[model samples]
Target: MKFDKPAGSNPIDRMRIVGQPRDRVDGPLKTTGQATYAYEHTEIANPAYGAVVGAAIAKGRIRAMDGAAAKAAPGVLAVVTALDVGALEKGDYNTAKLFGGDRVDHYHQAIAVVVAETFEQAQAAAALVKVDYAPEEGRFDLAKALETAKPAKDPNAAPADEVNGVGDFDRAFAAAPVTLDAQYTTPDQSHAMMEPFASIAAWEGDQLTLWTSTQMVDWWRSDLAKTLGVDKDKVRVISPYIGGGFGGKLFLRVDAVLAALAAKAAGRPVKVTLPRPLIANNTTHRPATRQRIRIGCERDGTITAIAHESGSGDQKDGGPEAAVSQTRLLYAGANRLTALRLAVLDLPEGNSMRAPGEAPGMMALEIAMDEMAEKLGMDPIAFRVKNDTQVDPEKPERRFSQRQLVRCLTEGAERFGWSQRNAMPGQVRDGRWLVGMGVAAAFRNHISLKSGARVILGRDGQVTVETDMTDIGTGSYTIIAQTAAEMMGVDLDAVTVRLGDSRFPVSAGSGGQFGAANSTSGVYAACVKLREAVAQRLGFNSAEAAFEGGQVSAGNRTVSLTKAAAAGELVGEDGIEYGDLDETYQLSTFGAHFVEVGVDRYTGVTRVRRMLAMCAAGRILNPKSARSQVIGAMTMGVGGALMEELAVDTRYGFFVNHDLAGYEVPVHADIPHQEVVFLDEADDKSNPMKAKGVGELGLCGVGAAVANAIYNATGVRVRDYPITLEKHLEQLPAVA
Candidate 1:
């Protein structure tokens, strides 16, 4: 199925099943404790447990390991150390070698894995395998390290990069009657998915099978095959249901690889689940970023110059956050530049998190826009509406397939009662608390990827869709079932979905908020072939055939679909292919977030009153699931604004806050009433699904709304992330 041009009104245009807000088909099984997670799978014969021991020092040489004591422990089957992984090879994505030996890249790098009959025995034995280390100094500060850092080594990248303006930005800002320049820093963040990294690996001769909790199953399988020096065809990875990923599980981690190696050594199936404390250290984190924004606008509120520069630290060969990607096309600015700088740091490897660049980038950019709006004595909504750009600023000939940012903003402002908000900050007092309202623009690019799937039409009129797309709690199963139902002209109950299995066709696994739209479009493409097969088998004109109510009809002839499939099951496999349409258009999702917050005068504590998000992403495939994605992201934004921070231990070159207790996310009490409204719209250029993306849009600009609200209420602006009371307590006006 080639997505050459914009999609047309096919069977999906009926809006019978695709547009309905439906509950998850797998919800009951999950709630009843029947869903099997990676670590919970004990169906294999003689499943053993494994526990990992990490190096104590951040940067050090491992002197020795005394595993004799651990081997003497009861039920201790085997112990594998870095020395055991002779000539340890690194994966394509990892820098600062995994399973480090002789040299330590970061604190708490895995040194050994202990396998035993029981989890407790493995843990107890791991604690006994002690080693001596000679600590060495390592870099953890971004600013200090960036001084000597170099640009990433991607030959194909433009500028490689040092983007500059066509016009003088300094002169334009100096001449501008209204301008705002601010610098903001966002701290390193943890994905903090509900389920920790877990994988169960079993070996059958040279072949390996891993039931893991992962996002990119095929990527993990290929990487594992490369790391193990085996054929890619020999490894099979299955991950049908995931608790959550949020970009944390998008890449293969130590649990699966180490479990496979340990099991092969022990000659038994082994399961490894990283302890909550170890997840923050061993796994990747969203690198902390320092962003500087400069916006120059005319007196009437037209942006003349805009720039976004972001900096972050990672191992060599790694790239920066690319936080400026949206700034190149978001609003209208002739003289604009965006650059990403990478620095070397000994902290844990920094990588993608939900919305990654845009999430943190918007946290700073949106607030700066809000500040600029306030400085100009203009409404934030009007300021954003005036600067809306329909075409890509970098290429003026291309236009967006569909853009409703202004509609979203205007509608959201009206629905949120923007007129009720008083411009005066502390003057809007509610009871004893000072109240204020703030709004920011949300923008996230609608990315597409090559995706494939297979569908089977059974004799019982049942359709099953198979793909390697992991749900990650994003309702992949429901949306997929809906897609099949809409395509096959059947009810929702007639479709079944199987996902996250390497045996299935490769798909654009859940990441970058593209999973729902792109993956389901792949399913739609596959089902189209199946529909034609069903009609042909029934000897009916496929063009006139309508599948509904468990029957297929064409003109005056009608036949039961079950009978059409009686001659064995009909299988169809296809993929969604892309052209250069995305290159020709500025494809992106947009939304507006409005927030009301109250700041305590005496305590310097900020509490959210109400929140609302109005989005203009193409089409809503499933309203229920779409709302869940947006609301969950909004809740995450709350955490990013007030509490979430991965405190770095600079002295040790590691993230000091290693556990959930040390790193806090938002709970129900932390977030108040929240609502989301999706504008009825569609973008044909995005794909057959006519949807852009909604998962990451809720995150873009949400934190900024909270920060701006805090400023409006307390008249104190905190540039750093977490907006902690410590940064404002001293500056706050003394209470009466």
Candidate 2:
């Protein structure tokens, strides 16, 4: 089914199941610890354990490796090094090599894996394998590398110049009555997901089956085949359950590679789980970014010109952070410019995490917006409303399919009690605490991808849907069951969803916030085919047939849906493809974040008092799950604003806070009461589901809102992220 045009009145419009707030169907299993993760799978017989030996040097060549001690270690089966595998091809999705050969690209790059009878034995044996390295100086600092940064193209954009622009930005900015220019920096961040990278691999006569923790099963399967130099069909990847991803498990990591190699060497199944410290420096992270934003506006607060320039570092073939993407579309401006510069750095590979570009981009841009609002002596929400655009600012002919940013801000302001916030910073006080409220606009582009699913109608009246989509703790299982139940005219309990198996049809696979909408649409397409099949078997016109209450009705004739498949089980397989609708319509999700903070007058410490997010993503599938996703993102936003940082060790070219003990995230006590409100909306141009993603939208602009709130409370503007109290403590006003 090609979703080339706007969706009409479809079966999903019946609000019986799709829109209802439903509990996760997989919740019982997860809560009971019955659902098995990658390393916990017990189906394989007598599985060996593999422990990886990471390289100590960030950049250099391994002079020599001594595996004799490890080979002689008790319970040690085999010690496989990169040299044993010889020169191997890199995966298409991998920016840095998963396993280092003679050359080490980054710190903690896996150099060898020790297989043994038990995990402890493998770990102990891995430590016995000693290696000598010839270290070389590598680019470790983003600020120092920025001097040599070169203009890079946005991977998501069309083929064009390195810098994208419209009209004369310099001239307009110079002529504007009010202008603000500032630089902001966001430090490197870890996904810090609960589930570590883990995998269990088994081989039989050259065929390999891997039970792994990953977000994109098909992508990993294809990439693993390429990386292992094997036939794609011979490899199978399964991950039915995942603890958490946050974009960390979206690609093939070292765990899967090492597990496969160790299983081959040991002549048995092998399970590999990466150590906690290695997760930080061995895998992907959100790269640090230095962004300079210039906004030119009139006294009335109409944005006349805007330019956003961002610089970030990555591996040699890696792309920039794309921090300027949201700026090009957020507001209405005649003269605009957005540029991204990439610098080569020998840090862990930088890639997507949560909201990625917009999360960090808004951390800087929205704060700039607040600053500009102050310059105009206007309320920040009012200033944003004044500059709202119905059409794309860069491409005037393209109009937003559904834009409710103004509504989100207006409604969120009223709900959050914006009128009570004092315009003058440091004026309002609640005992020993200074109080302030801040708001920031949230924006994330809607993306649709080709997704397929297989639906089976059993004689027992149960509908089963199979797809390679992953849950990743985002309620994929429940939402998919809801879609299938709504489509098949059956109760939610009667539908079963099997996901994250390579044998199933390929789906969107949970990334870039596109999983929920696109994957469900695939299920809808398969159900449509099933409906047609049922109509044909019952001798009714498919177009006029209605499926309801487990019965197919046409005019005065009706028949039980079970009768259509009484002879045998009915099967349907289809996928949702797209045409130029996305190009013609600027599909995006909008939201507004309101945060109230109390700053310690004496200590300059910040505490969030309350938080609320008003989101306008099209047709939320399940309010319960959607709210969970939004609140989770809001919590991450708090972390980004006040706590999270990777603490780069520039001298050594590695992350210093490699473990959770040194790295800090928000605790339950640190978070305040959070409320999420979804504006009722459905984008016909998006897809058959008419739903857009809310997970990333909930995070976009949240960090900026928190930063703005801190500034409003203390009368101090700090452009750096993780706004530590020390950064503004000395500048705080003296205690009264």
- lDDT (Cα, tens digit) per residue for candidate 2, span 1-736: 9999999999999979999999999999999999999889989999999999998988989989999999999999999998778667788886667874698888998999999999999999999988999999999999999998999897656654589989999999999999999999999999999989999999999899999999999999998999999999999999999989998898899899989999999999999999899899999999999999999998899999999999999999898999999998999999999999999999999999998899999999999999999999999999999999999998999999999999999999999999898888877789989888889999999889999999999988789999999999999999999999999888988999999999999999998899999999999999999988888988999999988888889999999888998989899899999999988989999999999999998898899999999999999999999999999999999999999999888888999999888889899999999999999998999999999999999999999999988888888889999999898888876632
Clashes of 1: 0
Model 2 / residue 402 / CA error / Å? 0.5
User: Top TM-score: which candidate number?
Assistant: 2
- Please, what are the lDDT tens digits per residue for candidate 1 over residues 494-566? 8889998999999999999899889989998998889889888889888888877778888888888788889
Candidate 1 has a TM-score of 0.97
| Residue 728 alpha-carbon offset, candidate 1, angstroms | 1.9
Clashes of each: 0, 0
| After superposition, candidate 1 runs with Cα above 4 Å error | 93-96, 151-160, 164-166, 734-736
Report the lDDT of model 2 for residue 410.
98
Regions of model 2 farther than 4 Å from truth: none
